[model samples]
Target chain A: MGEIVLSACGLSKKYGLSYALDDVSIEIERGQIFGLVGKNGAGKTTLMRVVCGQSTLFSGSVGLFGHSGKRGLAEARTRVGFMIEAPAFYPKLSARENLKIYCMKRGLPVSENLDGLLASVGLPGVGGKRYSEFSLGMKERLGLALAILGDPELLVLDEPTNGLDPIGISQVRELILRLNRERGVTVLISSHILKELSSVATHFGFIHNGRLIEQLSSKELHARCSDALSLTVDDVEKACAVLENICGCRNYKIFPHNTIRCYDGAVRPELLNRELNENGVGVSSLMREGKDLEAYFIGLLKEGRANAQLY
Target chain B: MLNYIKADLYRIMTRPTFYIWPLLLAALPAAMIAGAGGMYPAGVILAAIPALVYAAFCLMALILTEHTFREDMQLGLYKNDMAGGASRSAVYIAKLITGILLLALLWAVCSLSCIVSASYWLGGDSGLSLLKDMASLQAASLFLRVNVFLAVFQAISIVFKKTSALILVYIAISAAMAYAMKWLGAAWPGLAGFIKHIAGFGAYGNFGAAAGAPHAAGGVALLLAPAACIIVLAAIGSMMFEKKEF
Candidate 1:
């Protein structure tokens, strides 16, 4: 409902004969951190590149901040900051010097608050160190520093916490959250670390073999993955009536083969089971079912692979 | 484009190689003058100055192009530039212009040394006059040759992304092309003349006598060849660069 910060529609990018991105469409609204979930070579980076204008598309369009077309997208991209793959800088130049180059290229005053920006990324006084001499964690921190240099409205970061230590990872996670909460910056981030992503992402798009298999918000994904009291009953109609009328259960879903799942209504499993059985809706089986984000993504990939084979 | 240019200037000027290369270039005249040791005519050394300067300029161009482009390609900095909203043509042209400006600085240092040496050895009035004459005679041709070499090499660097491969392939092609032109010239005289004129070799060979009585038609054609080559080569280079994916 908020202004769309990034909208990529029907994006397809082909390398040789295979598709790096196949008919992918994604949109991120203002202040949303959309995590691109996929294994390696699953089109996450390619999709990010296409959105950032680093890679040309075979068939599709990208609109940023409601701006489309060549000239418009170009002008729109200036408002976006991106760090794709490795953080690239002159190896000989210090982190501060590299950030200054970015400032100059973006036409900002060379005197922009670079030290403050570096400090914000947890790279406070190390700005004078050469990039070549940086640890991978430091490099990633500087990359973050560069991405936030111009106070961009949108940040397209690919694996921003890639080489960080555990504390560094938490720092980056906190930084992303703070940026989103404070400055309202829209982020399109991709990472192999799904758990880390789950902690920060407001929404997610699971990509598999160059196709986006699913897109859901954090709330929706939680609802799908949340613990559920599942029951297999003899009569589906009777079971639904008994659950609704007697047990005071309001949130539940009925599946095939007379199976039912109750979620989010505080319906105790043993009590519901006995109530259903007592109400003449023979309860055949009862158990709890749930999944974490990783399990859900793996299961989605498998399902997608099977469907691709079927097609 | 101006932003990129400014940034590139700041980067190159900060590096010590920018100053070192031109100083080496300026020292060429002194080195050659010491080696000549009063054996050859002063005019011969002066005439030979452009040739020595051209060779040094070529090396400088090669190093400059490698410094300007190859490092970026290897490190993937171009991705940062293009993603930051700089047009591809702007990045390419900005680099080319930076290389030219750096080359111009080298040219100025070398020219000043050549003039200073010429004045010291040949006396004031006559040395100044002769230096002025030779500069006018050689300026356009030398500038075009260096520009064409830089532009062509840059185009090659863009098209061929690998640094070692670019160097090996460029050297092989240059050697092969030189021999091919030589053999073709042996077979056909007019073609040889045309090749010589276009390649600027004839201008260098005839710099002394040709200064006062330049053939207007031939001179125009000579300038046009390299000038047109630069424009066409730059156009093709920029086009390829624009379509290149990070």
Candidate 2:
């Protein structure tokens, strides 16, 4: 909706022949939080690492704030604030002191505005209390506090709600929303929690086998991951032939008892049954399958796995 | 660069290891003095050994570097380190400076111990004049030189991300350099003088010489040589680490 703050073009990273990230491309607009969702080993962390310069690039490039050179990565990174993987902090330092350390290192104008910063993350009265004493959720909140130091323009968090309790997740969610809506900072968050991500993400990017399957707004994902009907028959080959030739319902799958989740919900079940019966192909049952994000993710990954075995 | 340096310092200051090392070094000469009671003159000289021990302590203290970088790298601290106005060069330099400061503090303790103890025992009637002697001055310079050498060695350990290997390398510098120099002397003439000179001894009985008479070697070069070595090693380390991906 606002400026395109992060533009990744042909961004790819490979380990040996297997690509960790394969020619992935995406654009993140300013003032809008972009959620990057993928399964384990799907390259979300790898991509985040490359963008922030903790990891290297095998090919292609990422343009952050319009600066695009190997040497320029350091300069461009100044505008981006992030908490990577599981966040770490000075275990001995108090929350207020940690902020001071962060701010002092950035050479930003030193402020005793520690209270406001801590309060933003709901960590009031955290002064003089060492980080080791904080709970996992409290530590995560403090990590968020450090990330927001000096009011960075774009905040990148990898599983910021990781290991946090329900209440803690809600706190992080609220904080992210406030930072984006109230503070006007763009954010890029990567997580495997589908439903949780689905709630706060204005946009989504589906990464399958280190490749971009789809990069759409939450509205589009919701539309795509919507409910559908699946039919399971006896022989998948026969089911495919019957569905393709007789019913002309081609968009589907032939696995786990010849299942087909029909995207075209308007298909007539009676007609389909009649054709399959007339064709001598046995039909066991028919049921509706909603857009299960987890199932879709597994399907995409399996497809990739199958493709890999071919080579 | 300033920001990163400050941050590195902040990180170091907050580390338990950081405080422990400095405080130990600061309090060591006094502690030994109190502990030895009547051990007298040798107690002070033994204090010098501890000062040198601190230098070794610094060279071997790769865990500080490892812990800082590992926590950051593992927890993704470098990403934010850069985002907080620190470039790669700044990060590298900050660690470098921090390492040197720790080494310097270690050396200062040793030198201060030498000054105090030598003032008590050797400085009698000679007053502080014994400290001004060419031999003591030479020994002080050698100690400073060792500090720089160890600092550079520690810097390498930080960049390479290996602790045991660097520790071995540091021990070699501390224990074997002099022997290696002696061996080199018997083996060759030009190499002999070079080894003896860099080894910080022309005479075994000389100030820096270990409890015996010594030979003759470079004088002005003695002062300039360690400085040159530090600059060159620092450059090599800085260049390697500046653009290195965390």
Candidate 3:
């Protein structure tokens, strides 16, 4: 594990009686792009708000840069930058002027390459334009610039690509990758765009109904999603008998119409086909089946709901 | 906290209201002088000027609050400050300080304009003498009133999260309390003395009596009401702010 930059344990926030965040605990190490995936109102934004100190925690502790107490956490936050929800700025003020307010607030010199920073975010030459004049994509780009304003060690962005075109999304993805690779900044980003998130995230956390159901590395997720081998046969009963007795394929599920899917990663498809054929079971179709990020999350949600129902 | 104050001041100056308000304030007296002419003596006119300016000062307090803090909750500026490592108390106090600073600046400008304009346009030593006599007490009264107004408006803004609602609620409560206190005080004489300290409306009589009596007993006695409100309201506001989630 790399050095842990952000950690939250038993975090919960409540509104009236409903829990916005229910005992969510997550840890993001340095140089890791941690992607938070959830449906709307699943507590993704709530968790980000709590971590950024925008909301008070009902119960739990958050440690940033190894700091936990109020003052320590506050001091730790100086090294962090975030952009949660819609990017808000003084509408009448120009983009540069809006950024200058933050610069002054953060004690950065007003002359600190604000135009260069704006240009870096793909907002070149528009720093003098009023914020209200900019399009939604421009606003999102400005938000990204603000998140990286202080060259922070940890960047927390909630739906950074919320209202952007395909080109804009790709640019944001490349920017995140470049920041992580070159500057070694840890990022905790939440997005509904699972495909975009999957492309950039080094780790994933799946949240459902305010609960974090699973957390895993990208490599582990890929392995879990690709391990299934689907097969079809002439006779389901004969194939199952041969697989159980000869091929030793025990971890498998049978579906209707003579189809079976094997979850056992050790079950070699070539060997199983030969064994089934020799045992007088004809093999008709065989292929590897894998889930993309979206399907994997949906399957996880289903399993989570099923387990919840079981208890 | 200092950084917040600095940033807030920068934003405040960017607004057109900051400049428009003072000019508009100065225009009020100019209009009075233009129309009233020699019908009222310089002494009478100059003596009445503080009341006019202070009344406007009260309205200016509300406007300043609207401009400075109206967008805090609406635009999530407080979120930016808190997320940048400022404590809630720090943010609240920073806003308080910013409002107070701007109010003082406006007070200075208005005071100067009234004094200089009266001296220039309203002739004679009588007008100047009248202003000098009432300056200290009026300043004190204005200071206390403006601070109290600012504290109450800020508290309302933070708790309610709506600027228009803040203005309406403040006006409603002030009016309601004034009438209630008058009725209650008339029916029960003993409650008047104690009730006067309970609300800011009780201080209205002090401003008129305080004119020309540089250090009047009424003015000194009225200080306790607003000073206490400033402290209590600020403490409550800060505490509530600390508990507030964004």
Candidate 4:
């Protein structure tokens, strides 16, 4: 992994009687596309806001580019870009005019690489059109262009693809990939589209009820999601011995209640059942199961809920 | 800070309303002079200077309230400025400076128009001396009074972040205070006299005094009183803005 671009520790925020964020801690490394997944009101937006210095008054510390505290965070934020909730723009101004204002405010030379910036976001011919006339997707694209105005090292996007069409979605996905691969910009994105995120995210953090339930790399997630053959049998020691010695199958896990799960999908379930039966292992049930990212997320949330019930 | 000011200036200047409002205000003095049969005594025009100057200041305050403070906050321009790495205090100061500069521009246009109209129609150099004296005093007093209004409005804008509500509250409270002071002065002269000295607008009390006598000391106090209020109010406003979330 590269250097840690953002690290939030023990973040706790409350509004009135309820806590929006409850001791949430997260870290994003350079060049990584970290996906934050959570249900509505699960503190994903709150956490992102705090990290980007939008919402303050939280009880914790945030380190951006290895800098912490008010002064440090303000300095570090110069190198960070973000689009939170909805895009903000002057309704009366044209796209070019609005960008000109933004560039001037950022202390960049106005009109410097402006056309290219607009073109990069697929807004080449629409510079003269007022921002209020643009559609939702177009507004989102402009927002993205504004966020990347200074070529920020870190991009914090909240539901960037929310208002995009299918083609726009794919374009944004490719854009994110190209930015990460070519510019090495670290991205922190939150979305409800699991399949879309699964294709791009390098790491995943699942949040439930204002708490981070799980965090894992894409490789680890995939490894945990591999297809498995679940088997119920008597004499679990003999079943394991038969599977390893007789069938030459070593990738399997034994559970309580004399159950075993074999992870080698290449080996047929029938072959394993036959081998276990011929080895005098009494098999009660056998089933093949596979999980995708969405199913895995659901399973994790369920497990989190079950654990919560216990406490 | 310069970058923020530049951006704000661009935004303010591009709108037609910015130029249109000032032109309209400049026309008022010409219109008044024209309505008086295109000729009046120098004393009549000189006596009207204070009222016209006050009108200009009021218009400037309305513009600042509507254009700079309220519109920026409503459109999330302040957030955009902060997002671009501008310190909150810098943004606040930039807005103040930009508003003052624009108002000053408007004041110049209106004052020049009035002077030109008087010179063209009234046709007298005797009243010119008194006009010049009152004009300078009114200009100085107007600057201080406008700064006070802008500082107060800017502070309110930072705290409330809502333009329409703030303006409504400000106008309502100002009217109420004026009426209350008038009533108090009529009911108990001594009490009102004491209260007027410490009021926020107390600094401008010397405006009339300076107009009559044109004293250097009163003029200096006129400038310093608002300057002091601006510093204290701007500091408090800046601290509030710095701590504001979003």
Candidate 5:
């Protein structure tokens, strides 16, 4: 419902004869922690690269902060920050020095909130240690710090927690939450860690084989993923009346072809089936199922594969 | 573009290679002074100074151009720069400007060391005369030649990201071309003469030749010719870089 921060439409990129991204369209709104979920080589990094202007020769239109095209995109990107694939810094320079270079390049004053930024990323007192000497988690932290420089409104992070320890991951998660909640920075983060993403993402975009399969808000995803009992019966009108009156179940949906799904977990299928039979609704089939984020993702991919085979 | 230049300069400053190479070259003049110990006449040292500085210029220019942009590319700093709102052309121009500025800084350091050592060991008056000649239009011609060579090296670095491979290819091509020209000159004089004029090093040779002779007309030609080459190569490099992916 907010202003659209990023809109990419009909993006297609190819290497040799293979398409890296094919007709991929994605949109990110203001103050959203949008999670991009996909497997390796599924065009996650490629899409991020194109959006940030790291890669070229792709056919598409990208609008950021209400601007598009070359000059407009460059102007729009002035307010964006990103770290793609891996964190890059001068190994010989210290953390502060590396950040100093970034700040200078962003045309920000060198003395503005640098120490605070480092501390926020849990890199306090790491002044003298060179980047080469730091651990992988430390490097990731520094990369995050660099991406947040100048208080950029939009942050595009690719596999930010790829090499982090548990503690490092939690710390980064907290920082991301604080940045989004307090500073209102919109985030487009990609990762293979589904549980971690499910914990923080306001919205999720599922990409498979270089195509976006689905985009949904957290509420909608949770609703679709919750446990439910799927039932098929004759006379769906009688089944709805029996479920509400006899089974005391109010949360259910009646579909066409006399199919009904009950979302209420406590509703017993045997009791519902008996009630439907008693109400003169012939019960054809009944099944109960539970689905979480992982199962849902696998189901989507499986369904996509099945459809591909059909064509 | 200014921000990109600043970031590049900062990166260059952090790397020891940038300062170490120039310092090593600057120490050469001091070494010459120490070895001479008045064994050779000051006139011989003064005459050798121009060639020594020219060699140092070429060495520093090559080293800086070979390492600066290629290292940044390998580190993926260009991606960071372009993501931070710098256009591809702007990033390319920034690297070119940084290389030129670094070359100037290194050259100044070496030239200063030579001046100081010559003044201390060879006496003040002769050193002043050497400085005067170095400040002349002939020295400007030499600087222009170095710029052209640096631009060529930069273009090579842009096209070929591998540093060692680039160095080998550059040296091989230059040596092969020089040898081929030499052979042709011996075998067929007229054709060889025409090829030499079109060779990439023609302006460099002219500048070097004019350094000793101090011909005004040749100096002017040397100035314009290398400047033109540098502009064309720089434009081509920029276009290629703009189309480059990552």
Candidate 6:
């Protein structure tokens, strides 16, 4: 509702035999953390490149914030800061110097910008510290700082935390959240870490085979993945017999050891246990269960692949 | 665009390669003086005759500019910069400024050397007056023209995305033009008269033909011709770059 910051109309990029992106379309609302999830070679990077104008869109159109003309693309680019792949910098220059050069390149007001930008990324006091000396985590932070140099309204980060350690990854995750929540900046991010992605994304675009398999909000996904009742009993055989006899136990799964996962979305645990106890089965534990994103995602992917094979 | 141009000049001027070129060029005239010291006062007039000797020197600046282009692209710096609102023309002009700066550095070195080498001669300049000599002025002017020419060559070098090919083609064209100009100069004597005069290539012919009427004209003509071609070539290259898929 705030306004679409990025909208691609039939965006397609083909590399001869392989359709890198086939008629891909998505709209990103301003100030939203938009997640682009795809398998390897699913056109995530290619879509990003086309949107960034790094590579021209081979088919269809891209309009950035109501500005799609050449001048519009040019102006929109200034407002978009991207770290496409590995951060590029002069190996000889320090992180600060690289930022300074980037500032100069963009003609941004840089009186105190470099210091503030560096500190914002947790790279403080990196005055004469040459960029070559910085660790991968540090480099990724510096690259983020550079992307944020102009205080762009939108950030396009392609695997920002790709190769970072757990700590580094969390730090980047926090930084991204702060950028979006605190700064009110729209973000389009692509990564392999689905759990981390789900934590931040307000909307998701799941792509496969150069096409968007699905696009849904968190509430929508949560609702669609059938909820279940989970139970942990001391005697799995007893719970299985009790469940099989119950009216709603036909679809339940007896997990390894002493757990039975019930797929009946509306069945309450108290009622289920009371019915089981009345049937001469004692229960130790019972709780309602819901499908996790990973499970739901796998189901969707399998469904998509099955459909593709059919066609 | 102006900011990008300024930033590019700053980057080029600070580079060690930029300073190295002019110093190498400055040594050329001095070497000329050292080879034929006191043998001919006329040699003073003929001292800097082999202008094309430093063509290779200018080629070095072209190489550096091409290298900068390659580095910017490789470093993803170009991606970052272009991601901003900077125009492709701005980048092309930046290359021109870099080439000019390198040429300026060469001029400074040559001016210094011409003064020192001329000093050991009977009619050499002394102190601050060394740079004021007419031959030093000529060398400075030629160096300026060379920078402009190099800017164009460097810009075109990137258009083809290869430095060696453009440099080779550049040298081949220069040689071909020289030969063709001479052959044409004999037939109508005025066939390409306007082009040659515009180029000023015939102003100051090499010293062995130092006093020939064509030499002085060739020197002045060389002043503008290549530079003009460079400017035109740079413009074309800029358009190509803006439209080409980088």
| Candidate maximizing lDDT | 3
Candidates ranked by TM-score? 3, 1, 4, 5, 6, 2
Tens-place lDDT digits, model 6, residues A1-311: 77999998898887877889999989999988888888788889888877776666678888888888677888888898787777778877777767776677777765746877788777789856988898888888888888888888999988888668897788778888998888888999988888888888888888888898899987887767648777877777777776776654678787876788988666667777887778766677777666766777788899987987999
lDDT of 6 by residue, B73-97 (tens): 5455666666665666777667566
Every candidate's TM-score, chain A alone: 0.83, 0.75, 0.86, 0.83, 0.83, 0.88
The residue-by-residue lDDT of candidate 2 on A117-149, one tens digit each, is 888777888767998899887888888887887
Candidate achieving higher DockQ, 1 or 2: 1
Candidate 5 docking class: medium
What TM-score does structure 3 among the candidates reach? 0.88
Give lDDT tens digits, candidate 1, residues B108-221. Answer: 888787677667765565368646754663466667777777887798987687767877876787777678778988898677656655554344433544434333246666
lDDT of each structure?
0.82, 0.68, 0.83, 0.79, 0.81, 0.71
TM-score between candidate 1 and the true structure: 0.87
- Report how far off residue B80 is in candidate 1 (Å): 0.5
Task: Please give the lDDT score at residue B101 for candidate 5.
Answer: 85
Better of 2 and 4 by TM-score: 4
Instruction: Report per-candidate DockQ.
Output: 0.71, 0.36, 0.69, 0.59, 0.70, 0.54
Writing each residue's lDDT as its tens digit, candidate 1 over A1-311 gives 99999998999999999999999988899999999999999999999888878888899999999999877888888989898999889999999899998899889999988889999988888888899999998998898887887888999999998999999999999999999999999999988888999999999999977888899999999878867888999898888887888888878898988889988547778788888778888877998787878998988878777987999
i-RMS for every candidate: 0.8, 2.9, 1.0, 1.6, 1.3, 2.0
Query: What is the lDDT, from 0 to 100, of the residue A298 in candidate 5?
Result: 91
Compared to the true structure, candidate 2 yields what TM-score?
0.75
TM-score for predicted model 4 compared with the true structure: 0.85
Cα displacement (angstroms), candidate 2, residue B187, comes to: 5.6
Q: Sorted on DockQ, highest at the top, how do the candidates line up?
A: 1, 5, 3, 4, 6, 2
RMSD of 5: 5.8
Model 4 CAPRI rating: medium
DockQ of 4: 0.59
Q: Please state the CAPRI-style docking class of candidate 3.
A: medium
For model 5, what is the alpha-carbon lDDT of residue B54? 69
